[model samples]
Target: MEKYDNIDELTGLYNLNGILSHLQGHETRAAEGSIVIIYLNVMNFKSFNQRYGFVGGNEFLRGLAGEIKGLFPEELIARTAGDQFIILANSLDEKEITDRLTMLSEASARHDKGLRLHIKAGIYQQTGDETDPVIMVDRAKIACDDIIRVYDKSINFYDEALSKKNELRQYVIDNFESAFKNRYFKVYYQKEVRALTGKVCGYEALARWQDPVIGIISPLVFIEVLEDVHLIHKLDLCIIDMVCKDLRDDINSGYAVEPVSVNLSQLDFELCDIMAEIDKCRDRYDIPVELLHIEVTESALTTGADFLDQQIKKFRQAGYEIWMDDFGSGYSSLNNLKTFDIDVLKIDMDFLRTFDTNKKTPVILAMIVNMAKELGIHTLAEGVETKEQYEFLRRIGCEKLQGYLFGKPTPVDDFNRAVDCSFDVCEDFSLASYYDRIGEVNFLGNTPLRDKSFEIFNNLPLAIIELQDDIAQCIYANRAYLDYLSSLGFASLSEANSIYGTTNHPDIVEFTACLKRAQVSPDHRAYADIVTNGNTVNHKIRFLFDSGNRQAFAVVSRNTSIHEESDTAESLRVAMAHVFNQYFRVDFFDEDGTVDNIFLNADQKSVSDYTRDAKEAVRLYSEMYIYPEDKERFKKFYDITTVRDRIENTKSAYVVDYYRSATPGDNGRMQMYMILPFYYNGKWKFISLCRYADEIRDDDLK
Candidate 1:
């Protein structure tokens, strides 16, 4: 059973500091001297999401999380965004694992149906040699990297290269949001050229962020984080928007602008309605869509080929070409040719690394180039830096080449000036004039609640949950639902396995199934305490269901014990007035209700004054501040919900006039923007309030 004292209500991620009484229990469990790290990531979460929607994507994740919990008890689990899920288990067997996995896999396949969940599981045994549990998990993760990317039987052990990448990736995650606004992130472009002529054709946009303190940011590091914060698509949009604006202006200034290709993240594919957004850009910039090109990772194409196909069709309709990027990066690259329509296939630079005139290069390169030609697809060689590499590619009949041979990525402004009227329109040209060496570069750069948290007791709705027997599955939760897990130890949720932390604290079995059932039902609301029992927690819980899979649960924890009701009339007025301003508009009136002041939910005092008008119209309209249709509704609501004295004011506005409103939603919900008619001086006038609910408890106000 999960029990804790404090439930943090801020961000959804769990914290350390959990069940203190079980501290010794954790030590003993660690002393069992056996630990297993299972780095299990959901394969193709981004693809699934792109095909479905975010809600469905999350439903898949939540459901999978539940199934995983059922498979392992006394294991720590934390969702590392996208499809990655980590598990740290204490004292388990090899045979038991296989049996458990087979059982779970069959069950999941049955339950998930069309929303298939093919998981990549990486395992490592902790021999107590590793000081940090995270390191043990890293070892397991190294084992799973290829499996995650491509399901294979050969599990790799941790190596220097993988570990280095892991450290870089983990660091980016730890500082994701903060890194975006930091100085590190910047653009890096690789040149794309016409192969036969060996001149620069275009540049494939890239990202490189270098930090003074943190070195470089790797794409592996920040990409997952970007997806979590919903910023990847925004970043892509920002880049595309900037490029379109800059490129259009340059083209008109007599610059021969070759189409540039931009790499799109999976997050971009999912969040953005690319077709509509692209059309908007085309119209806005009045530029031919063919002037732009987009490259999708071959892996990305392999998983969500249909979506890419539709996008490709859309772009072509809008007159743009599509390229399959990093063609040799994975085995799926070749398959993508069969599955997806493409205008170009950019050869990976790795092939060049093995190039020697007489060696393995000529036959393979010649064969690939011939294949592209036979298929009627253009072949572009990527990373042709040296004269020898460029010359060799040209002889092979490749149509395009991109590398340091022509010019590296330059600033948009620099490229515009550098490429202007400089080379033959038909010949492959170089941006060599603008290419310059940059210093060292650095790295480039989801879920809800669960059960096990409901064991603790709390007040109001937050405590309103009943576990599904000892399975500890949360069948319900109230408004403060999710906040009950914050500040709870994350060891359970994370790899620490402290027995008190959230990452692993309470394993809720089949959690996704319950949520799916609830989501489709009208009575989907429920409550549970998401913290431990040892401490005095004032948190609430919230339950949300994943719409797509409908099986996953997004348990949100909230702190709702701070509402303070004041006795003083002014204090009460501020509190009530704030609720109105925050959610709607509120007004106040005097005892006799004889021309008491009026409250207007806005500033710009130069406009009509509510106090003056409210008093004059009070007798005829007690519903003076409220809309006529809402007047009776508000009256009844006030009668039942309000506990204060004598029909206080009973007026409010976001009103431009007696019959009209200022802004559509200006009726109440904004403290400073609210207009409160008070009995000030001899007349009634609406006083603007810019107060919030929590600020009402402040003694400084009195």
Candidate 2:
């Protein structure tokens, strides 16, 4: 009856109290040779119980105890706790003990074929230095806990180094509350840059510890300690508050502010209402949701899927962007991408660190970027440290970049001062939106076309140019386009811009017509055959985007090799040119209302000698050519002061006005005049064209 109370009812082994009682009586025997205390712990035991039920778990533990007793027949053994056992062996030979333990593990696995058991042991050698059995057991358990996550090692030996480490961990745990209360932690910001422009687009907030006694502690150490104690959420929340306050200060000081992202540990969600806390901070500071981002690691997605899914949906519904950090660093990255609605994939830096040695790095990175783009998710490459890496990432179409090459993490105040001196800070939120759109385009590589079938568009043997605004400035051109420009006797895109410098250039006029045709076409596409430098080229123009005064188009061109024309074709072409000359004329003006150039196709000698001043020229042309009833309206159409603003307000590339032709004719006929305003060479310019109203499509002008 007395012995029954000391034994575990299920396993028939001595319990914790019984083991301690026996060890207390045999302390003197440890003086002969070192007594080894082996503390055995079964990892993931709760998972096993959940999988197989309490009955099955108890049966497995009983069988496991029998195996342990058989392996150490002469040694004292006791079941100290659930899934834990203590072995008191009178030997110092580690190899012999390890072999017996290995046999015990093998025998248990053989008994339970379905579940593989993982057992870890911590060995402590006692030379009679201390007599307290509880302390000895705790030290052994500490050593075991150190290797709980390390699957490769089955045992850990207690040593002085581990002792000191445990001491520091305890110190951090003891001082954490006071340290946080006194504001010993500081938040540092690392800038996220736009790959193409090298401009600061956002920041990632990182926490740093500023301990008074230890000076500075690495996050690796303190963060691990906090996570071990389940106190990491405090630090994370503290950092968030600091970042929000700093942003509020900057906004009040009239400094340009960008979006800031904060990292949330997995424990944060499990411990507290993280989203509500973040929202509280945001509302307190009055920060826009667009200026705050949330980041979660890929590993964090593996657990609490349903709960995290809800959290993610809540975050997105609240208008915050979610970024997956350390992408490709885990095994299930692709699956995570599909499972969650992530906005940005932060490619792990390890890929870039091993870029030179690992031949597959570049291939893997390209696939990730392309895959994310296809899924409508943006990509940001972290830990980029070299010019070569920057260029390669830019060429591969990475949307954002963050690394040491841009800048190291600094305090918010220091970062602000540095940005003021060296960085291009976006002053207006609208300008930030503009940069966001521009940054999406990769000038060094293939543009992400709207159609999936055109994935290989950039690889085709054709010249490609991305024209923007009404002036059709060559904002971006592929290598083929540059080569085509070289073939046309232009050394660079800048040189090629001379042809598009004036809106009245023949090519510009024709290009504008093609754009208008595209706007009216069902598919928003148009085709044209252009003759430049004695070469005929076929161009396929696709309209991409239009917002306010901004417009983008992709022009794909290929040479036709038809430099010479048949005699009949040449004659017809000349006859068409003669007819076009009789009907069309264009006038160009500078920002100051001065006429810069004129393209008068008709042989009109009377209107050839008008004054150079745009106002005077408009008055003379209106008086000489306009019908009496339309002169004031025609003059208003040429108002240089208001023309550009009107065109901009209209949000169209060109504006049109109707007037009657006053030139000598059999009868008065309605004529249309179009005005195009553009900025070039640091000045605003205007182009005006006159044509028969019947020849122009009314829908095309819209």
Candidate 3:
């Protein structure tokens, strides 16, 4: 009866009491040398049991115990607790112990029905100083718990460092209640600004621990400890309450108040009615529900996904906005976006951490923004600390922005003081309306002339200008439009604006008439021919928006000469070829290395015999016209197969190569060849251009 009572019924292994009794007889041997105590726990055992039945779980444990006994036949083993096992070894052979542990882990995995059974081991080497087996087991347990949340490590050794860490963790857990009641956790607000205009649109609330005895405790330290103890929900709720009170006070003080967002932990929903607590705080403070946004991390949705989905629905139905925080930080980010109806995606700052060094970061960021826009969800880029990052996000149509560039997280009072002093806070701004207007314009069109540089509109080929009010004040112009202004004898857009304000230029009058027509038109689009510097230019005007005192129109300009009734298709083709030849000598080729056509200015005489094969023709031309030093480069540039592969691999619209000409009247001037690939009808075609390098702006090449 005593033997049966000392053994575990499920695995027929020694129980805790049996192990302690055996250890008492080995104390004299332990005092002679060092002994090792290994504590092992099955990770996620509860979830495993939930998946497999209790009978199945018991069977798995029995199999694992059998494997452990087979591997450590000479050592004493015990089934101390549920999903936990203890081993007492007389010798401290680290390699031998690790080898057996590895075999046990592998055997358990091989028999894991369908779910992988992960086992974590903690080893404590005793120098014969302590006689208490319970204390040794406890120390081993501490080492195991230390790595409970770590994924890469499976085994840890007990040491004084781990002991100290456990002590600190216990201290935090013991004083959590006191910290909450005494208001040691303070709320900090980080401003979120409109990307288009640097105006404060909203703020995110963060919690900071101000310990009375230890000065300011970093959230990184306390937050992790609280999360491990499942007390993070308490701190999160306290933060929500503090944010609500602060907003109410701000309203009472007649300060401009924007929506403040609060973060919630996953445990909050499981431990308490988080939604109800939030609603209670809102009602208690008499604050509007719309003024409070809820942010949940993407990783939080991985566990209890269905419950979180329902909870998110409840919050949305209650008129609270839901933002998925730390997007792209987890593996299931896209799945979570599809499962939950998220309003905004707070992009992870890790993407921008290597923004300068990593080339893929900007491309990934742009794709995320575009994908969110297509799904009708907004985007907010966090950790924007530079002007370059700000401009990039703005150009990519990111709706909201946050980071140290605008301001760091601060206390409510300090934030208010900064706002009163110099912070640019937007009052009564409607972010929805702003994004709605921005969404109407398709900045990246599928047209052939559209530039691939999505980071800046200045690289676009068409002249884009923004006009305001009835008098047609030029408010903004892209680089193309600025160049167009310079063509009309104005050094800059400001010079042209000065002329429009002082005198009635015929072009201004015609543009103003076009703007009025666009405003009244059903589709808000109109076209007009404006005369400037003895040349007629066609302007297509579209009404953008009207803000009581001012109205804006987007004006796209093109030369009207080609649109004349007298110009036939053949004449237009010839005229266009001639215009293109003025800047670049052109060649058209098919994918099969066939030169279909060529266009050159009168000054550029053909120097090689015409050939049907495009690749051979390039080689022949390079020999005849390329400088001796640049012949190899010129030939390589025209390698049709290489160019085709490059375009396809990079998805680039065009590729450019630079070289010099060796022709008799040429002075070895730097020349650029640009190759553009296109799919026409049923086959691929390439358009190649030869131009003097100095004539083109660097921005145009982008």
Candidate 4:
């Protein structure tokens, strides 16, 4: 009935039926010519189809068929599946077949821009014993699959080893659902230790599959196989759900549970809504967002794919911490860091191992640590297997560490046991020394300052100034110092000091000279008498210099005659200082909905605009940083009436709420704003702390 009954409608090629019927005649004359069956595949055809639509994919196939026909017109050809082409060539050697295939690839690329094909092939040379076309085709397909599995290989011949691997892969695919139903999959975790303290801060989740029939399968092998079969998303989602359930169980059982990071492939986002999937598991198990972390590799971000950008934003907005794993293994590793809102930079252990052999490796590692610090991003060194690598990274200011040195990834029971007894870093390891190496001049807890001096600095009756530069500038000062300046009708410490005339004041002059001398000597101090507020008081000015941070500090302690301010002003000062030191930006709005003051902690490496002008600050907050969809909501929340009502109705001393906005780095990542309305200076003033959404928690806010 049909003229070419076995012809493929799309490619005009002989279908499998026609090819097999044609092959029946060739089998009788096998001895007359050498027969080689070649199976060609369009690698990543699904990705191409996704990148371009179905129509585009079909067009590419049609163009590819034309090129294949031009190269092998006399050979028997067939369209097997969507992206596979089979060819039976006679009287041609292996070299001739290779040459023709290479030519066909180039011609296809030249014909149409969209027709460039990444071809992988498998070959089977027919023997005199072979008679069935189905057997030969199956062997060729197995050979093709071997080349595809390697990915780097272009072609492979059918062999026993490749056939075995194919059989294993088929077994996995056929029994995947059964294995899952029988609870064969498992989630393992490796502890991530704090480098300075050696405390187990968190764990990284890894997958394990135990097949009853096959005993155990390596994750690397099975993960690749799952990806090939488009079942990786199912596995990834399963792992997420398992991790969440485990976290909930651990908490219920009173096991000290830490956050666990999970690896997600690019395909996970492509297959379904990643955010929705996460929400499904989170809601099902009632898991807190902070208990889970998302890890994407450096290579994944290097693809410059739009899907990653969209998915990352949604994850961040939903308060999920994002870690960039394998930091230095990609071509665009450093560039990806600049573009992504990656909270932790997990340096690959390969970089550390190379330090012993490569002269420039340590320098590069140091540079990465410094760059990450300057960008306000924390660094985590992964795969640390030796004491030397751990010390080296600690010295270079890596915040977190994880590897074989701590302990390998283990099952839930083993991980809990290992972490139960707590561990400490080596006895000789000093956190202060590590801090010195990183040039951290400011200490928050348990500082080495004299006890009396520390108390006076916080609860002093006078202004305490900490100068960080050679010039008469203040980097930090206590609440008493700020209040004193405000009492003098000065808006800022800088303005008040300028009016005091530091050049003529002997104490100020000596303080500047002491800082310069401390650049070379550690123990440097200068004392002098100066008149302030109509009183001549003795002042003790000490120069503290940190060579590592390349910073010089002048700690000036003088007797303050005034100890108290208006209750509201004092409360405002304390809140402002705490918010400023912790967050990148803090804004204080008056009861009239006007920005009264703004404090910005700008990273030198990043672009920033921190204008003190109230009107301009309001415009920047409302128009520039706030996303279009959130602007109206943000405005409504911060309105004068809304603020007054919230503070009154809220039982807590401060009314706390959250809103989203933009930051200088990673435009897609919205900054979480903790808006608190407090009674300050006899009116309702809202103080908002601007931080990355991942770092905030609803429970903590409440």
| Lowest lDDT block of 10, candidate 3 | 563-572
* Candidate ranking (TM-score, best to worst): 3, 2, 4, 1
Better candidate number, 1 or 4, judged by lDDT: 4
In order of appearance, the predictions have TM-scores of 0.44, 0.57, 0.60, 0.51
Which portions of model 2 miss their true places by more than 4 Å? 5-14, 26-32, 40-87, 92-122, 127-131, 149-155, 228-230, 328-335, 416-702
lDDT of 1 at 547: 38
lDDT of 1 by residue, 1-702 (tens): 233231112212111222111222443333235766666666656767777887777666666667777776566555654666665566676666656666666656643547666666677776657765556655887767645555444234455666676677667766655656663566655566655444445667666656667776666556655665677776566566656776687578665566667777766767879657766776788767666787777767765667777777876666677888778775566777887778778888778777764487767877777666545567777767688787767666666777766776665535445543345532322342232111001001001122123233333333323322222234455433333344333322222222322333332322323333334444453222122433222221233534342233434433222223211244334434434323222334333332222222222121112443433443223343345554544333323123132335443232211222222344543222233344445644333333333334455243
Candidate 1 deviant stretches above 4 angstroms: 1-31, 34-147, 150-184, 210-216, 227-230, 357-360, 413-421, 424-702
Local distance difference test scores for all models: 0.52, 0.75, 0.75, 0.68
RMSD after CA superposition, every candidate: 29.3, 20.1, 19.6, 22.6
The C-alpha stretches of model 4 lying farther than 4 A from their native spots are 1-21, 24-34, 43-84, 90-117, 126-132, 145-151, 196-199, 228-234, 249-256, 270-277, 283-286, 297-304, 326-340, 345-382, 391-398, 416-702
| Clash-forming residue pairs, model 2 | none
Candidate 3: where is the Cα deviation over 4 Å? Answer: 20-33, 46-63, 66-74, 90-108, 127-132, 224-233, 253-255, 328-331, 350-371, 381-407, 416-428, 436-702
Clashing pairs in 4: 439-549, 461-560, 462-560
lDDT of 4: 0.68
Pairs of residues clashing in candidate 3: none
Candidate maximizing lDDT: 3
Root-mean-square deviation of candidate 3: 19.6
* lDDT of each residue in 243-297, candidate 3, tens digit only: 8898888677666678899988888888899999889999999999889999998
Assess the local accuracy of residue 232 in candidate 1 as a C-alpha lDDT between 0 and 100.
Answer: 78
